[model samples]
Target: MNLFSDIRDLVIDTLAAMQGAGELPEDLDFANVTVEPPRDPAHGDMATNAAMVLAKPAAMKPRDIAQVLAARLADDARITSAEVAGPGFLNLRLDAGVWQAILRAVLAEGADFGRSDLGAGKRVNVEYVSANPTGPLHVGHTRGAVFGDALASLLDFAGYDVTREYYINDGGAQVDTLARSVFERYREACGLEPEIADGLYPGDYLVPVGAALKAKYGESLLDKGEEDWLEELRDFATDAMMELIRADLKALGVEMDVFYSEKSLYGTGRIEAAIESLRDKGLIYRGTLEPPKGKMPEDWEPREQTLFRSTEHGDDLDRPIMKSDGGWTYFAPDVAYHFDKISRGFDALIDVFGADHGGYVKRMKAAVSALSDGKVPLDIKLTQLVKLWKNGEPFKMSKRAGNFVTLRDVVDQVGADVTRFHMLTRKNDAPLDFDFDKVTEQSKDNPVFYVQYAHARVCSVLRKAAEAGIDAADATLGDADLARLGHEAEMTVIRKLAEWPRLVDTAGRANEPHRVAFYLYELASEFHSLWNRGNDEPGLRFLQEGDPATSQSKMALARSVAVVISAGLGILGVTPAEEMR
Candidate 1:
């Protein structure tokens, strides 16, 4: 049960009563009314803007409306006191029984306590970590993978039918370069000096692909021309790289539901169909774009090209779909890819891209909007760069990847759980610094460890309770006398626990998984604070001497924190630490 939602409904019902009694206007919009936690906890448990938002509409002063509403709210048994503050806002203090019910709900629901149905099972396709099949995934792609995986999990938890997807960039010239790189390695395996061309991939990771090729073709492809072997090698090299990429993702515990090929859009009439759909909508036409503003007019040549009317759908300007030579531009295939997604009947689409792809956002959105006739909304999230630090210095690049740190490099040093949790410590669009020293250190400063430690502490309490011959299982704790948990310190932690369902819905709606990390940290802080307080006040301890009843009641509260933490960490793709060593 969402306590905030319950209180909001109470406020709404009270307002409707006011209208029925002729104390307020009959027809007033209460859609803007909100019940939320007060900015300052000292003020009250919750606050509402019902009076403030309804003042002008109701033809009444905010304070006048608030005064009457406070009296109406105080009539409810759940609302202990409703006080008017700050001209119009009504702050509410709920009865202690309300928090007790929330704790009972936590034990009853377990991990599903915070699950939301805000999405209503709408199909959402989340495309992320679409790195080119050239090498192992690097640090930038690592951030995208973690962010996207967590986001997909969050959406699923919020009741969205989420499909995690990765688009292969194998149709580009880069794959051709990869073919040549593998050819060199194949030559090296054939007992010849392999030429490490300047523009070709020089990483030794391709050496195994070359050895496999040699094993298959023997000396038959040794003297073959580029035309004869390029196509076969392109497929072979990409498939090999994809296998390695999958392994890299596996190391980080990421698995995509679909692996879309960029090549599938080509030579299959898909691109033509997508463009024709835009043409039928009068959004596609032959046109010459205005030269860029900073360019010299004399040097600018205006050539006719096929363009999409992207500006009509919120882009800054129309975008070209095809080049002057009649070949599809990079944007054309992406449009076709999204068109395929739309054809599949998804309710919404989300693309998680690197910061470098920021320029493509508006146009891609415009394409999906036009293609889906604005029925399906597309949200694009850009993950900024991740700077790796080790031993108080910038982490060096990987020899396997040649130029950047591979995802495996980071995952190998720190396990997948730590890597995933730490990566989400910042928003997708914010730059993140992954410090090995700080993240691995077992201290309160480390958020991952801190949160995990709270879960472990709960487990420790349960273990000690069991050793003392007290039944601390969920079934037993859930039935414990929760009314005994009336201390202010205990209520504080329960209040934080009560926010989980609201937090899940908010994070899911905003498509911001970082909020989950932030919430987990705050919840951990509240739990740890209560745990520390137990040292000075023996009465606050979860286990009491010669008082089994009180001990079970307090232990129930501690178990509720673990339940929420486990649920939160599950959304982040991090395993809850049963024991932190």
Candidate 2:
């Protein structure tokens, strides 16, 4: 049960009663009325802005309105006390039984306690980790993968039909560069000294791909010219790189529902269709854009080209759709891809891009808006950089990736669970420092260890109770007389549990998975604090020597806390620790 929503409804009902009594006008809109926690805990448990929002609309003084609303709210059983505070706000303190019922609901629901239906079954397409198929995934891709995967899970829990997608950049010139790089390795495998050129990939990760090429083609293509083997090598190398990327993602426990190819837009009418849709709205035109302001490139020229009027849809400037040589711009295929998503009947589209792609956000959103005619909304989230530190210094680089740390290197050093949890400790757009020494340290500084320890502590309590023959199983605890749980410390734990449903809705609405991690850390902190309080007051402990019912009730509350933690961790793709090993 959402106690905040429950109490908000009570406040709304009381306002309606005031309207009936002519204490407030009938035409005042209550949409802006909100009930939330007071700024100071000593003021009240919950505060409402009913008087402030309605005062100007109803042509009445705010304090006069709050005084009448407070009297009406105090008549409800759920509201134990209501008073006007400051200028106009109405503060409310809910009855103790309301917090008590929330604990019982959590125990009854298990891991499903905080699941919400706010999405109402809308279809959402989440596209992420669309890296070029030139090499294996690196540490940057790991952060995007974990963020996107957890976001998809969060929307799913919030009742959205989420589709995880990856856009393969196989149709780009980068894949052609990948072919030439593999060809050099192929020569090295064929008993010839390879040319390690400046623009060629020099990583040793492609050694196995070259070895496999030797196994497949042998010496047949050894003496062939560039034209005879370029296409074949391009196809072979692209497929091999994709296989490596998939394995890298699997190592990090990420799976996509679909892998879309940029090549699919080639020789297809999809690009024309998407452009035509924009042209029909007068958004496509042929014109030369003004040279970008300040420090113009040497090659900047006023050449006429096909452009999209992206400025009409909130972009800073009109974007080019075709180069002067008549080749499609890099953004053309992207427009077609999002058009395809719209055609698939998704209500919304979300793209997770790196911080470097921040420049592409506006034009892409303009394209989708024009193609869908404002029917489908697009949200683009840009993830910032990750800095790696160890031994009191920055980790230099990865030998396999040649430029950065590969996802495999991080996962191999610390297991996937630790990597995933640590990556989400910050928001997607915020810069994160991944310090190897700090993350793996077994202390409160490590969030992954701290949260896992809370779950393990609850397990230890149950195990001890079971050894004492106290029937401490979930089924037994759920059926216990919860009214015996009257201690203030015990009620604090229950109140925190009641915030789970509200927290789920908030995080899902903002499309921020890091909030779930932050919330879990806060919940663990509260649980740990209550555990320490038991040391000062022995009667507040989970185990009471002479009272079975009271002990079972307290255990029930602790178990309920465990249930919510497990559920939140599940959304983060983290396995709740049964015992810390």
Candidate 3:
């Protein structure tokens, strides 16, 4: 199904044959040889650097090797012409039937056409949107959620065993703050004047948590001290907020396989066990270190404390695990969590963090490397802020979220599909602007609409074909005489279609899911261009007047574009629209 890989394999096999015939030396390291689409279509279909790369190693001239390789490749039935250009670069033109064959392959495979076995079923753990479980998720969490979910799907489509995970930040002082905030609401529910103190959550979303606490505890424990109620309310409020978080994620069509609690690492000896693992590796020591350049933590004084030698493992400084107050630092539990993940036997780990967590990247990677002895690779992806605009001005925050816009706010305004697609239209580290006016427009400038319109257009074609009684179902389209689809406009789309499998492989390997969004945009652009041409040049249209065979051939090509777009959008976790509103 991967035409690029197939062509590359053919080029490699032809080189091996040249060696067998004594025309070239044996074992010239063809690993670096590549066959790729040429930059300019006028040059040829594919350009290979086989001759250019092997010239020095093969003790031959670049033009000499290219001349021989070109003749041998031209003999193959798949390649129509192989010409040497620019000092041994080989530009090849495949038989016109090859593009048709790739289109038929798309119809045959449908949703699974571009899937790859690149991961070889290796287990990969993707942790994202691990926002504090203190309130409903906000817009910052939304970008991480969409990016992480799409990345997990992309890795799965690339044949990895993926587990979507969310690490709940419920083990810190923030939970205590949540408890105190909910306690004020609880007092309000008890019909008493509640003291909504400073440094407490003031969102109206917590109003229900207070009512629920009163309903459960009654008036007996109403005036209890903080010691009696802090722990219990912390647990209760954490659960309530997690419920809200889950609803927000569900509204965006995200489902997590695990919700690991940071508190689970405490009192369970997991953190100690993880530190002991590092201790056994001679990576833990008691040492006094330099204070950081920025404003340092109170516990970060230059005193001897139990520290992990993270500098040896690639961190900027050795990090203290135990503070001067003898309590664990914030990083201890994170190290333990990744240790738990490594012990779970994942071959790789990926963490999706907010752009604010960029400072933790090196230390966290160092922790995982030390914990797993570098056997497990960790990649951290940071999603930057999303600036929302409405009516050509900056959007206001949600009062329900207390000065920040919640994930539900964005989803409720523009819908989940639009939110998801627009979030991915930019790279994870780049800032994104979600314009309400632009995203919902009917014009081609909007990527989500343009791509969805392509799929919907194909559906419209299928309907017209069915109404015409031409029987252009997906089942019959693959068997059409696709050779009739030889126009440059139609073949342009087929050339784009042939790049899907290669695109998925490259994007998955690089851990960049935004490439899928970009590819779909390009594919849609080509399809839309072809469709616009059909208005004036009747022969370029999907339907022909009274010619079912030619019409089916063209329809097959159009439907194949939808098939690829559906597969791409599926990886992005956005459902392809069958019909646009």
Candidate 4:
């Protein structure tokens, strides 16, 4: 059960009673009224802005409103005390039994404890890791994959019909470049010294692709020019690179529900169809954009072009769909792609882009807004750079041009679990420092280890209780007399457990899955503190030598912690550790 929501409902009900009694005016809007944790723990468990929100609307003083609302809230058995602090804010303290019920609910729910229905089964398409199909996924793509995968899982847990998607950039010039790079390696495989061109890919990862090309064509296309072989190798190399990319993603515990081809939007009347949809609304027109501000690029010109009135839909500038030439611009296909998503009947769309794509956010959002006629919402999240560190220095890898680190390199070094967990330690837009030494270190400094150790500690408690012949199964613990869990230290951990549902709601609404990692770390810290407290106070220990009832009560708390941690880790696509070495 969501304790905060339940308590908020109680507060709302009391306010309605006040209105019925003529103590407050009728028809007051409580949409903005919020009940959340107090800024300071010294205030109380939760603070509501009900009085403050109602005061101005009801034409009454905030303190006068708060005094009566506080008294009305105190009448509920669950609320132990309701105190008005500051001008009008009401702080509430809940009964100890409330926390006990939350623990029981957690044990009963198991892996579904923190699941929410906030999304209400709305269709959400999350497109991420849409990297160019040129080579293996590197560190930058790794961050997007982890963040997007975790976010899709979070939305799924929060009751969204989440579709994990990858848009393959096979229609771009980068894939053409990929074909030429592999052709050079093809020459090297055909017993000729290859010319490693200045703009060609130099990574050794393509060595196998070259060998496969020879095995397929076997020197038949060796002497052919670029015109004949370019198109053939473009398709062939794309398939090979996609296979490598798929394997790399699999190694990191990520699987997309769909792999959409960008080329599908071209030559299929889809681009014209999307533009015509906008044209019907007068959003598409022929106009010349102002010369780009600041330093003009070599290609800048003043010519009539087909542009979309993106500024009308909140974009900074109206964007071009087609240049002065007859050919469509790069953005034309993007507009068509999002139109395809809208046509698929998704209620919402999310694009997980690398930080460099920040410039495209506004134009893309404008496109979706115009194409969907402001019906469908688009949320774009950009994952920032990941800086690798090792041996107290910046770690560099030459796995690709620009000295990029491969996803396989990171995953192989510390396993998929550690790699996924550590990558999300920071938010998607915040630059992250991936220190090899820090993430694998078996200490509290390592959040992954700390959180995993907490789960392992609960397992150890279960084993110890089993050896002592105490029936500590979840069925028994869930039915135990949880009233024995009254100590302040024990209650603190339970209070944190009660925040899980609210956490899921807030984090899911914000579309920020990093908050899950943050919450798990905080919950793990509180649990570890309670475990240490048991050392000095025998009554707080999970195992009571002579009292099976009290031991069951305490062990129930430990198991409840494991339940929440397992659920949280599952959202992050990291396996919960039964035992950590």
TM-score, one value per model = 0.99, 0.97, 0.97, 0.98
Give one clash count per candidate, in the order shown: 0, 0, 0, 0
Judging by lDDT, tell me the better candidate of 1 and 3. Answer: 1
Model 2 clashes, total count: 0
Query: CA lDDT of 375 in candidate 2?
Result: 89
**lDDT tens digits, residue span 487-581, model 4:** 87888789889899999999999999999999999999999999998899888899999999999999999999999999999999999998988
The residue pairs in collision within model 2 are none
How accurate locally, in lDDT, is each candidate? Answer: 0.94, 0.89, 0.94, 0.92
Candidate 4: the clashing residue pairs are: none
lDDT of 3 by residue, 408-461 (tens): 999998899999999999999999998988999999999999999999999999
Distance from true location, Cα of 365 in model 1, Å: 0.5
On a 0 to 1 TM-score scale, where does candidate 3 land against the true structure?
0.97
lDDT of 4: 0.92
Instruction: Tell me the spans in candidate 3 whose CA falls farther than 4 Å from its real position.
Output: 294-301
> In candidate 1, what are the lDDT values of residues 1-581, reduced to their tens digit?
78888899999999999999888998899899999889999999999999999999899999999999999999999999999998899999999889988888999999999899989999999999999999999999999999999999999999999999999998899999999999999999999999998999999899999999999999899878999999999999999999999999999999899999999988999999999999999999999999987999898999999999999999999999999988999899999999999999999999999999999999999999999999999999999999999999999998887788999999999999999999999999999999999999999999999999999999999999989999988888889898988888999999999999889888998999999999999999999999999999999999998999999999999999999999999999999988989
lDDT of 1 at 396: 92
Candidate 3 residue 311 Cα shift, in angstroms, is 2.0
Instruction: List per-candidate RMSD values in Å.
Output: 1.0, 1.6, 1.9, 1.4
| Residues 409-447, model 2: lDDT tens digits | 899888888899989999999999999988888788899
